[model samples]
Target: MNNIEKIIEIKDLKMTYGDKEVLKGINLDIYKGNIIGYIGSNGAGKSTTIKILLGLVKGYSGSVSIFGKDIENENNDYKQKIGYVPEIAKVYESLTAKEYLTFVGQIYGLSYEKCDDKARKLMRVLGIDYAYDSRLSSFSKGMKQKVVIISALLHNPDILFLDEPLSGLDANSLLLIKEILYKLKQEGKTIFYSSHIMEVVEKLSDRIILLNEGEIVADGNFEEIKDSSFDGSLEEIFNQLTGFKKHNDLSSEFVSILKEV
Candidate 1:
């Protein structure tokens, strides 16, 4: 993977909202066809970086380039090759599943005929075969998630950004999605995956980039991450790097509190 070309690059990225600085001098590169697990706790600047990458948040001081083209010069034309599934399902609740997907496809400059065909096939595979005409407000969390996933994939983008994409999926859906992502990788698609599910990241990620306090804390594969001779899962490595201490005494402390009551 080291020999692979970088599809996205960020240099000296910094963003400040109001008085609070969110991203502080960040630098990173995303290679083509790499499944990068972007791990971070709440307020660790993960979302901020993604927003900047997708051209949502603006006025940040730094350089961001995609396909070696400066974003300032390229904007939407450059963004067309990217697909994003946000952490929240924020689609129009009044629209039916089919209608919502049509809207998304249109936003990506896809035709209604193309969207209908793609949406039906994707929904069938994602286990929403029967909900195409149903209102989005009547759908469950998992159902809505399926729709969001289909929307992002409707355009067959080169770069896919998934932020907690498996938020409301069931076991079957989770397995199916993992398989689908694996297939996408085989097809040479780059994926930026963000989630708190350490187990999933450990299993699927070709490389893990851990973010802490608006900076890159650790960036490498599992072996490279455990190069310090620590033998454990990504969760253990994460805890060690993030200054997490053993909570062996916390259980007893809580028990004592319960006893006091």
Candidate 2:
């Protein structure tokens, strides 16, 4: 592991929001070309961690290094090698897909002609080229998601931070995106995939890190994690590790309550 290229490193990472401790001493190292499934329940600090790593959050206590440089050093060069898709689609509603994507590509230092050409080609490949000239406000959830994905990759980043990227995609789009991610991994791109979809995470990740109560409780490959927890599936292991095994009982109780009405 030491000989491999370490792309991201977190040491004793801690963050507090008002009185709530969001991250409680997280220590992790991400190597190049690895797809990491960073899963956790809501408010378990998964997004917070990613935000900090992306330099969007501040006042965190600990050290974070990207590309062998400390993030706190105020060096913005590392950001050029990274791309991020937020949990929410926050595209400019009034701008056409071409306009928005072209602006994004330009921000990454691409020429206007290059950005426009690449954007058009990518939109065409995704089957959304017909709407490229239309306002983003008219795009469906899936279309907007596809645009965001394209914008993030326009810079050819070495690392990708995707937070719930498959939120509103259809089956075919989802399958294609999964294939794209796999191909990206083959090309030595590190992917930090944060999602609640256990099945996708289980199948896609080279390594999985499970967070519960602001701490990593499980970290390993699928088979290793299963063996360690003595569980059958990733979902079962997630339930066991997160200490949430009452789905059946909870459902039954809810049903009984409904019957009373």
Candidate 3:
């Protein structure tokens, strides 16, 4: 609504790598307390746009503003209100879960004692407190993902950026996480969720933005997107919008090749 605060603004955004263009003139506005599902296939500029928004990537041409402040300006204070869980969990394998979480919390301006206490409590809540003292190297993919999620929320950020956040989570954890995101939105926190799982996106997102090639092909709610294309589910709409209708053909060809002598 017009009364709600605008948390993120991007205008004429564009990025390139050498001769290849990644993002081509993206313009979008996101409001607080919204769960925005940003979906795209491989090389569709999804990650690139997220990176630029997070200040992790450079050489992008556009005007990006977060929390009403221009990110291009000299001030980096806006980042303090942002939390990000990258597509890959990059942890210090040598460090224990407690140690790593404590370190991350401290980076967010938390005191050592406070960070340690908070990390322990969070790990307990996530049912991973038993492995608190264990090195990250000993943790499974799902465990590591939980740790990353905790670290991102350690500061209780106003905005959360998640890429493939539920990648290796179990069914129970996945359901819990979805509930947690809903609670966070109720608290007026903005969530920018990027994933290839159309079902989850369809269920969780207040709005969906689908990108293709280097541009956005669709942006709306599930019903609106469906109405824009043929009547179908989100996955079918995605396939239609992306111009991909060859799943059976591709699978048959793949199996035929495997059958070859």
CA lDDT, every model vs. true structure = 0.89, 0.94, 0.94
lDDT ranking from best to worst?
2, 3, 1
Tens digit of lDDT per residue, candidate 3, span 22-81? 999999999999999999889999999999889889899989999988898937788888
- Determine the backbone clash count of candidate 1: 0
In model 3, what are the clashing residue pairs, if there are any? none
Candidate 2 ranges beyond 4 A from true positions? none
Candidate 3 global CA lDDT score: 0.94
TM-score against truth, every candidate: 0.94, 0.98, 0.98
Worst 10 residues of 2 by lDDT: 227-236
**How high is the lDDT of residue 239 in model 2?**
89
Candidate 1's C-alpha runs over 4 A off are 1-3, 246-260
> Model 2 misses residue 239 by how many Å?
1.0
Provide the lowest-lDDT 10-residue window in model 3: 223-232
lDDT of 2 by residue, 1-261 (tens): 788799999999999999999999999999999999999999899999999999999999999999999999957888888999999969999999999999999999899999999999999988899998999999999999999999999989999999999999999999999999999999999999999889999999999999998999999899999887466778888888888989999999999999994
